[model samples]
Target: MLLDHFDYEKLLVPLNLFYDLHTGGPRRPIFHDVAATRPELLELDRNFSAIREEVLNVLPERASIPRYHELDAMQTYISGTVDKDRDWKVFPLNLMGVKPKGFADRCPRTVAILDTIPGLFEAFFSILEGGKSIPAHEGPYRGYLRYHLGLVVPEENPPSIRLKDQVYTWKEGESILFDDSWDHEVYNSCTQDRVILIVDIRRPMPQPFDAVNRAAQAIMKPIYGGQIARKLATMTPPATDGDAPAMAEEKQTDDKEKASEELAKKLPDQADPVQEWGQREATGKAPATAGHSAHGDKKPDAPE
Candidate 1:
């Protein structure tokens, strides 16, 4: 569809180009070095066991957890499988700023740990079934950085993610962040499941562009995020929230710029094929418009 292609060219691509100016141009290798920034989230690592148990609470119904494509059909090309039960899976905590009232409330500690992260965007548990591989691809947007904290890393033949030419393995309780726009993919060589806590936070930028990213998010969240929230609610009945349905029904009384934000989310599958940006998504460009409500005045909705 012309619209799908448009998602690549106009709606988001230009905003992505803006990232190069501050992020040291695209030539730099992927995977950011963040040992200094590590201390803040150490609590998440210290309490890793409890977080895993919280996730384990929902593991019995793994089949019911939404696969990447289930959340955003555009990902079918990369996420694969028509059944939705097999391959790479995701259980969103906060997607595109909308919290799933039931699913998120189940893991109080995990939510609390995640809430502390700065510039938080999307937060979720990424579960990869044994011997699965997510096709090689780049995240659709460049506005936010991606972080992964290993929760259940199988020791033998464990899962590893490929960012550019390097292949990095996840170790229990350790974490790392990287620019997702760089080409990347995942592989799980073992027969055991590999689960990691995945999140995206707004990338730091100089002045005006930083605000541009937020402005874009504010416009699109209501429009594009609703489609994602609604689809996810249906896939996992238990995760459904009353607010999810109303997302599609909410009135957008804001200005045209705000309405433009909705456009990005409305046909989000076309926005960016990879990444979730809600995966309306932890997906796409224009420096990723917005993830959730403002951080300073955070209403405590829980999309962190």
Candidate 2:
């Protein structure tokens, strides 16, 4: 069952808060230091064509690929029923630090490139269906920074993400990096799916804290065990009666379309309030919090 996470894991809250307050990096909407990464992330850059090729191979099998929340319960709010018509799927290479056994072999060239990057925390290909809109939400920890290398993007009215006040549209082969701590939302308004290579890397911190952050991140592997289990089992083995299953899937799509219409009527515009809150927090008018509004839930939970 999909779980809408509304609170932070109790034990990890303090540590997450500590890093958010004392981290050495600049606090901004978008990060501009890709070259600062250890080893320069050139491996990913060099294998762009091969990586995109692998993603294109996976694209045709979107039905078999799991939805984001199906893999990680914590992601249910954005990848939940509210965006039913706009399916958000993922093809994961790694979650936290654990690599799914035999899974990387399917995308050998991409995995080989990923292996070269230092402090690699999470790596996956985010596949957003046409007209999908991920509600306003954020990751709690500042220990990691999110990176995206656009692979398959539609040229006409390309997909865009609003991080704070700035909206960035994805361009094929372009890279975008930012801290996910601030409330951000994504939308694929074009009537074409958008695919991007999403990776999370450890944020560079000073001395002992840097080491401490790495040790703390290890705890997330066990925490996200459910997601890993689902990812490992995502590929559907062909059954003898394939047509029946295909019909069932078609019905599911119809149900999703109905659900999305109802969801829109219930969930209010998240941008207005979240943006106001972000502005207040920046000026000390409001206290910073991991929780952000999503799907009309009681309180939003911290995401990875």
Candidate 3:
């Protein structure tokens, strides 16, 4: 029903502001009926049960996994803990626009499960430990819907997420689908750890919007892929001997920053029309016109 009224033929102007404006479309429920729209997701849910056990076997060495903030500087502010090993750990299946071959090889089952779903963009297993809280924030883009399947939820008094004004909890074997563009915060107050398989799926929009979204994604792929490539290059270990963990980590950070700087150079900074309009409105200033000045043109000293 929600997909019926969109203008499938209407193509959006390919601009950042257009996406920002469209992101305010009506919010869906904090959770969706996974069974109704995509029963296949349930199959993914089942596969993750085994994957969860596998993840636990290596939980002690989760440090080997790259931290989220290390991968993307934009996330530094809301990543909760500033430690090298974050309270919120992420085993990324996909980062930027590419999948890490090493990660995929390590978790073939998880990747296979992800492959079953069409339109899935980024996928990862997120492990949130007790007492950590992900600060309230909105996603940078609106073209995707964030999905979470509770793979290993706390048994009692589990953690909960607050999206906008509504609060929702995760139930193992069930999933929640919501627009991450909405302000949201998460708290894992429970004593037990919480793990979930997270993904961002291309938003299902009508005709022109979908086409426009596809075009936007295509344009972004190369930019994101470039950044990912640099990071991967540094992430791969040297053949002769691995750098000390600390040295390797420091190098990784340097590479990420360099890549980010390069990506920034490639991306044009979009002027914010909203901010410009607000400033004009606040100052009540109008454009100056010839022969109509605040000083009344001084009347040439009364033609003296």
Write down the lDDT of every candidate, Cα atoms only.
0.67, 0.67, 0.61
* Residue 147's lDDT in candidate 3: 75
RMSD of each: 19.3, 18.2, 26.6
Off by over 4 Å in 3: 1-30, 80-86, 236-304
TM-scores, all candidates, are 0.71, 0.71, 0.65
Task: Tell me the spans in candidate 1 whose CA falls farther than 4 Å from its real position.
Answer: 1-10, 35-40, 81-85, 238-304
Q: Estimate candidate 3's alpha-carbon lDDT, on a 0 to 1 scale.
A: 0.61
TM-score: model 2 vs. ground truth: 0.71
Give the alpha carbon lDDT tens digit for every residue of 1-304 in model 3. Answer: 2222333213333343455444545634444455554455666655645666555544545666655665555567777453334477677676545777655555667777777787676787787876667888877667767877766677678988888877878766566667777788886668777878888877766666677777766655555545644565567421212324566567656765665566556654845433433344222333212232111111111100
Q: Which residue runs of candidate 2 sit more than 4 Å off their true CA positions?
A: 1-8, 24-29, 225-227, 234-304
lDDT of 1: 0.67
Residue 217, candidate 3: Cα error in Å is 1.7
| Range of the 10 consecutive residues with the lowest summed lDDT in candidate 1 | 295-304
lDDT winner between candidates 2 and 3? 2
